[model samples]
Target: MAYNPSPKSKAILDQAWDWIQSVEYQVTVRWVFYRLLQDGIYSEKKGYRHLLSLTSKARKGFYADWRPWTLADDTRAPVLVQRQGFYGLHLRGHGFQDEDDWLARIKEEINCPLDRWASQPIYSEIWFEAAAMQGQFLHYANENMPLLAFRGDISIPEKWRSAERLAERYQDLGAPIHIYYFGDYDPKGLLIPASAWRDILAWTIVILNSKGLTKLEALESLNFHR
Candidate 1:
């Protein structure tokens, strides 16, 4: 029989799920690990330690395998799709707000001495903005890449229509397209994008971070054209 998560493990996983749903912090595997550690859900010597070890063991196979998660599946196959705006808000040490003050602060901060590094290769190419006039930070590429936004309950037909339009536009341009997403880290948040865009395996999909090379390696191992 396959091993199931022990009660303790399940508790830790539950807390991790709660944290992601809260969207109080930027979601990443590392953050998820850290949050679990903080909530006393896992200990440094036992549970958290073991989980980290498992991550290392699973990393190679996880990246190599593109198995979709099913409700009836025995194991959880969570995809970590890193989004852009999440990092921006985290960097600014705040969450979304609907005020010109926030944008002004961002502009000022970006131009500040401490933030001179923002103009470097990393930040220069990324566009940061507040959407819907709300404080919800939106991170996107400066390259005019196509994008489609959908909530969880949205119909597949609408999703496909957006994807078809995006694909056609990119094909017309003859330029490689990349799909970038930034959202809370959770089963639903990660799986949604993976499931929606799994067919676009030929295109590059990158997570934004210093660990980008690791993601690249994972994609390459999966035989993605990136």
Candidate 2:
């Protein structure tokens, strides 16, 4: 008979999932676990043990039952594995005119409220070159809803400038300032979200899977243990 995850393991997994979805938390499994352990959300020993056990199960083919993985298979590690399962592998094609054009599209998609005085509009988009695996993102806001913006190939400096300018413009018009990015899954991709939104629109930042339409099904496959 196969060993079942304990209730404690289930609790850890649930907490891990919530952290994974948090805009304030780092998107990597290492960082997530590190922060969780630091916050007393879970003990370091328990967290490490759970990850090790999951890894062992994966190696023995207990999770999938057909193919065995190695202990060195970093991709199967719990938190990072789940993050990859959630965001990686969904490649997106590039289709933005330029930075301004990209920003305009996001504003339109999320409906920026530059004309409003109370709240701002929220908007978000993923930018990537499907063929090359190079990708990035940006976000912006208006008066009514927090408008998230994204650009695939832009630089960090440029992203900052854009966000500042957008905020200034919205504030001048009596609109609330809001903006953020849903970053890519890897380390480099991780920096994009961190740099683009940092303190200005920090509350709105997120890490999202950019793989569009047809790729959604592929995403679903990652959830399957077998």
Candidate 3:
């Protein structure tokens, strides 16, 4: 069914669009809902469904000829495998003479930059509780630095893998790991990092010990802060 917004909803959408543009970043619908509540443009705690419908319609161009993806939901996006031959076709279209020219261009294109943190004494990462902010965080994050979003409380296996990665990095560079965490200041958000810190430390010690390192050595090798 097609969505037809009431005049009040249309005004709300215009306000939402203005706010979204002001931020200069794609935000989630939940973010928009909360913003409306904070701005007094909306009330009624259970009215989220109505707001979501209006936003969806606006994004799909059911109201005005609006841009499609004004609101973002990175988690729900489809993943697709990249096509390699497109590079060759693009080069040819750009007046490349032969395969040698295409091959040279492709080689340079595929040659990624040197490691950004090889000589640094600290292996740094950015962590957040909401996956929706991944794109925004990545916009300013340094190359080769890990970015992790827990999307709520992180799982045991995920923490184990994180520890393994940190252990491997410590073995390679002997650097202390630093995590610059970004999340809500709520009680649950505060607890997430605290729990993760304790668990990751224990997991890192276990991983390093299996490689014939002592507990004291493991403790010395692994360093992390939230």
- Give Cα-based local distance difference scores for all models: 0.40, 0.40, 0.73
In the range 95-128, model 1's lDDT, one tens digit per residue, is 5476787777677677323433223332111111
What is the overall TM-score of model 1 with all chains considered together?
0.28
Compute the lDDT of residue 207 as modeled in candidate 3.
74
Residue pairs that clash (backbone atoms under 3 angstroms), model 3: none
- The clash count of every prediction, one per candidate, is 4, 20, 0
lDDT of 3 by residue, 171-211 (tens): 77777777788888889889998877677787677778888
> RMSD, model 2, all Cα superposed?
19.7
lDDT tens per residue, model 2, 1-226: 1445567765655565566566653244455567568768667556765554553443232333311211222232243222224223322353566989867876677543344443434222233323133212222322234333344434333344444544344334433333333445787776655543442232111111221313333232211010
Best by lDDT: 3
TM-score of each prediction = 0.28, 0.23, 0.51
Off by over 4 Å in 3: 1-79, 82-108
- Sort the candidates on TM-score, descending order: 3, 1, 2
Task: Give the residue spans of candidate 2 off by over 4 A.
Answer: 1-4, 24-26, 45-49, 55-226
Backbone clash tally (model 1) = 4
Model 2 TM-score, 2 decimals: 0.23
